[model samples]
Target: MSFYLDHAATTPLRPSVVDLLTQSLLTQGNASSVHSFGQKARQVVEQAREDIAAAVHADRNEVIFTSGGTESDNLAIQGLFSSRNPIGGVARPIIVSAATEHHAVLEPIEWLAAKKNAQVHWLKTGSDGRINLEELEELLSSKAEEVALISLMWVNNETGVVQDIPAVAELASRFNVPVHSDAVAALGHIKVDFATSGLAAMSITGHKLGGPVGQGALLVSRKTKLDPIFHGGGHERGMRPGTLDPAGSSALALAVKSAVAELDQSIQLWTDLNLRLVQGVITAVPEVKVVAVDLELGTARVPNIVNFIFPGCAGDSLLFLLDAKGVAVSNGSACTAGVTSASHVLLAMGYSQHDSSACVRISLGHTSTQQDIDAFLAHLPEAHERAKSAGFTV
Candidate 1:
């Protein structure tokens, strides 16, 4: 059997979610139409909106469906920045984001800085992957009004590091700057309540939580102001305009609700699986080091991820070797997997190029089992040996 250990990339759609999608696809009419069929489709979409909102503890009107996380991130960042007041008749919007954010967040902020003359302040993180809150405070104090928005991921996709969102939100609130968090990784793995998070907006994707791909939503607070990124038929309150996919929305809501309901048990199972994986790796390969193992559990991490720095082996080589042995995993983000470049996230965490290139990430999900972990551990040492023989250095 193939061992799939790359939950961070994308999770398998739940069987229940697939059933919901299949049934919803048979329903007739566009959500935008005013006819009876259209009204039925519209009801499905609105019910889904309400379900998702309830799952995240937000109002139904606050959920604006989008294509996926990337679109949501762009809409949140660019929309907020464009809506900001121009400084001295020029748009001098500032964006403060962590150095460890996914490319979806980083690339957009970079575009704002390079093309829109926006100032970008990148918050540094320690080797443990925790953002420096003091640095954030300093930046906010110096440039509060000028700062348009702050984007940070609630969990690091590479290392499963959880950011301090409440603290970040409180800081942004003091300065009246809107905060946007990419909660894609944190959605099913953690309990995320928008009512308590104090964030202006958050991006969540469906595929990350056992739903279909190409569907996501931005949780926009009713009080927060944002301009439309796309202009068309005034769908999603005119913030994101297009024909809504009722099937995708229904699947997303059902998946999210199921995940939320099982979150506590899922967290516990993942924690157990991660502990087993870490311990098994340590016992099977004495030379390999588990990165950031000393950090307190659940304090800095999500329970499902275990990232390791394998000495004397290149990450890609080890990954391929494992693939040859019927196990599949990733060395870095799925979005950037084909590039073969060193991980920027590991580099920002103060790892050397060698260590960064030698890193591998194994993320688990609802379907992970102890037997799967054992199977992976069974193949790991041989994979490491072959990777070393192939002349790929640590």
Candidate 2:
């Protein structure tokens, strides 16, 4: 049987989500229409909104629907930045974020800087992949007024490193600066309470937590103002405009609710699987070095993802070798997978270019089992040796 270990990229939909989606797809009516069928459709959407809000400790109005994580992130970054810097207003054009953030966050920030005259202050993280809060405080202390927003990721998708978003928010509060987080990788993997997170806006996607791929949300606090990127109908609090997807929304809501409810059990299972996978890899390939191994599981890092570097071996070689052996894995972000470059996350975490390019990431999810891990381990030694023989190329 083939092993699937790339959950960080995307996980399979839950059975409940699939059932709800199938049912909703068979129904008809537009949520914006005024007829009885419309009202029924509206009810489905509203209930889904409420369910999603409750799942993340947010108000129903706070949940703004989007296509997926990329859209949510783009909206949060560009929308918040625009609102923070209005025409004829004081220039708060500086954005503070980390370099290790997914392209979803990084690209928008880069666009703002290059096209809109915005400045950026990238936060540095240590070798463990955790952002340095002191550096952030220093940046805020000097340029708080000029800073539009501090956009950070709640978790590193590649390495499973958790960032202290609450602490970052608390520090930004003193300066009255808004903070936005890309919580795409954090929501189901950790206890993410948006109310307690102190963030002005946070991005989450349905697919990451076993929901439909095209559905996601940006939880925006009432205190936060956002300029719409899509300007059409005044839907989603006039922040995001489009026709709503009742089936996708219902499935996403169910997925979020289920993921949150079962988080504790999921963590326990992943912790065991993580240890098993890491230990097995080390035993089979003694030269393998586990990424962020010094960090405590379920606290500093999520237990679902385990990144390892096989010295003298190219990550692409190992990835292909594993795939040929019926094991699927990833070298880095699936968004940038086909592009042959070292992982930006690893480079930001103090890894050299060689080490960054020489790493593989194996992420687990609800479908993961001990047998899956065993199959991966059983195939890994040959893959490792073959990859090493090929040597590092990228």
Candidate 3:
């Protein structure tokens, strides 16, 4: 059987989500319509919205459905920036971010800087893959008025490192600067309570949590204001314009509920599997390092993802070799616009170019089994041998 270790890219759709999607597809009527059939469709949509809101401890109206994580991220950053507005002839067009963020959050902030004259403050991370909280506090403390918002990821998708989002938000709050987090990788893996998080906005996608690929949400707290990204309809608080997909919405809602409900068990299983996989690789290779996890910090990184670097082997080579042996993984974030270059996350955490390119990420999910882990370990030694013989790519 093929072992799929790329849950950070996307997890297999859960059976419950598939069932809801199929049932909703068989029904008819636009949720925007006012007729009986439309009202029924609207009910389904609202129910899904409520479910998602409850999962994040947000208000029903605060959860705005979008196409997926990328769109949700764009809406949060662009919306918050546009809404922040300049005061008394000065522009508050500065976006504060970290180098370790996913492309979804980074791209929008970069776009604003390049085209719209927005200034970006890039935060640095330590070797542990954790950003310096004091750095963030200093930036916000110096000129809180000039800052639009601080966007950071709740977790590093490629490295599986969890950021202390609440701590970040608390610091930002002192300056009255809103914080938006890309929680795509953190949603199902951690206890994410947006209400308690003190965050102005948060983004999450369904596929990462065992729902369909297209559905996602941006949780904007009622206290925060956001300008519309798409301007045709008043739907989703005018933040996003499009006809609602009841099927996708209900499916995603069910997926979030199920994931949150089983989070404790899921974490335990993944923690076990990660330790097993890491130990097996290190025992066999003796020269590889699983970058983020530490004996002191324990599972500070998410339980599913384990990133390791082979000293003399290219990451892409190891990836290909493992794939040939029926194990699937990634050299870095799958959302890197198809580039196989070294991970920016590792580089930000202080790895040199050559060392950064030597990494592979193995992420687990609900469908992963001990047998699947065993099969991967069985193939890893041979794959590492082949990759090492091939040597590093220039």
TM-score for all models, in order of appearance: 0.97, 0.98, 0.97
What is the C-alpha lDDT profile of model 2 across 1-394, one tens digit per residue?
Answer: 6899989889999998999899999658989999998888989999999999999999999999999899999999999999998998549989999988999999999999999989999988899998888888888888898999999999999999999999999999999999999999998899999999999999999998999898999999999999999989989999998888888899999999999999999999999999899989989988888999999999999999989998888898988999998889999833354667888999998988898989999998889999889989999888888888988777
Task: Supply every candidate's count of residue pairs whose N, Cα or C atoms clash at under 3 angstroms.
Answer: 0, 0, 0
- Worst 10-residue lDDT window, candidate 2: 333-342
lDDT (0 to 1) per candidate: 0.88, 0.91, 0.88
Off by over 4 Å in 1: 86-88, 333-337
Q: Write the per-residue lDDT of candidate 3 for residues 136-240, one digit (tens) a residue.
A: 878877878899999999888888888999999999998999999999999889889999999999999999989999899999999999987888878998788
Clash list (residue pairs), candidate 3: none
